[model samples]
Target: MTSSFLQGKKGLVIGIANDQSIAYGCAKAFRQQGAELAVTYLNEKARPHVQPLAEELGAEIFAPCNVSHPGELEGVFEAIEARWGKLDFLLHSIAFCPMDDLHGRVVDSSAEGFKTAMDVSCHSFIRMAKLAEPLMAEGGSLLAVSYYGAEKVVSHYNVMGPVKAALETTGRYLAAELGPQQIRVNILSPGPIMTRAASGIGHFDELMHHAEEHTPVRHLADINDVGHAAAFLASDAARSISATTFYIDGGYHAISG
Candidate 1:
């Protein structure tokens, strides 16, 4: 792999639950581009899954961070300061909604489930950007993952669709707020991909097949494609771009039945 793009850069990639995760793809691409990395797993349950991937990437740090908890977020930044002192990029790939809420009608979604989804999927990015701002003394890039469901409704995407809408809006607000400091903020929306998180949503396989058949490209996005898009967005090449969401989907958003 050519290694000129991200040499000597340092970044924190949050929300990597396992090797198959989109965050994992971003982390790998960052490594290949010569960026040093740090990754966060949610809790003890995710350590074994995250550890090998961290080691494989030669990550400078690995820490536990549950974005829902303020203390965990504080501790993560503390560790980053103690180790790297400053950061060049931050990736927010965290999001969650109760399984029960995901498979049902949006009107049927419970209040608690809606709140949980918004907190984890939307508010967390806002909190992360606030926390990361001070640490990025030299200015930096911030990237978050979203989905087409945030706009056009996807069956079984219920509460998460709303959460992603909030997330995308948050990205725009942060982009505007941080632009003066030269910190770029953007969102990458990937088409249906087979990750563990997607597995939790009902009928994901059928959704994937449907996307493949309808999208102009006639195939699904590979993890690396999404990662490469992220790497570019987080790199100097994308310095002038912010307050925008880039679709990494294979033209799935443009087709009409």
Candidate 2:
């Protein structure tokens, strides 16, 4: 059932590429709970896919944001500042790595590829937190997507494992840094699910099946599951929670096969 858990809240959602994106799931759930939204598309090529989804969610601010671009990321926040004046939450759900580095072992990955992966997948969250902080004057939540690979060695998760590890640690530190202001920073780690981003991982199908089979629940979660968890974290319900990794992996992270 729909509830007004986030009624009157205003936030931004970055990293939605298409309908199957985790950011889309979060935006959908947040809207169902009555949160006003601002969304971003990567570029012109992605605009067609994301704009419709933003329209469907009634997002008041829809703009192009490529974090790698000089001012694109800043521009989105600037628009949010102009439109909303204040912010309640923000979700960062984008990650990228070149195919070669992703398919290669961490030891063999090139310096440039590793650096680019870290910059996009991990450091971008830090940049978002910095940009989102001032707008969250009334105290708000900041969330980023993480994975079990951050904590353990999952086959085919090579370079990203370390990248996510950095992200998780970054969230912890941000949580502590922002807590005094009543701003919360957290990471949401979900089990293997086929996302446009995940398509780059080598042997992804094998990874997904292994997760389902070994997971205590014997199943995996979908985008909606991650979305709901994200909504809860963004809501007043989790006011005291900060600097933590909230897992929506259906017992997969707890078991060993």
State each model's CA lDDT, in order. Answer: 0.89, 0.93
> Number of the top candidate by TM-score?
2
Question: Looking at candidate 2, what is the lDDT of residue 214?
Answer: 90
Regions of model 1 farther than 4 Å from truth = 1-3
lDDT for each residue of candidate 2 in 47-129, tens digit (9 for 90 to 100): 99999999999999999988888899999999999998989999999998989999999999999999999999999899988
| Candidate closest to the true structure, highest lDDT | 2
- Backbone clash tally (model 1): 0
Report the C-alpha displacement of residue 254, candidate 2, in angstroms: 0.3
Global CA lDDT computed for model 1: 0.89
State the lDDT of candidate 1 residue by residue for 23-98, as single tens digits.
Answer: 9999999999989998888989999999999999998888899977769988888888899898899999988888
Give the TM-score of each candidate.
0.97, 0.98
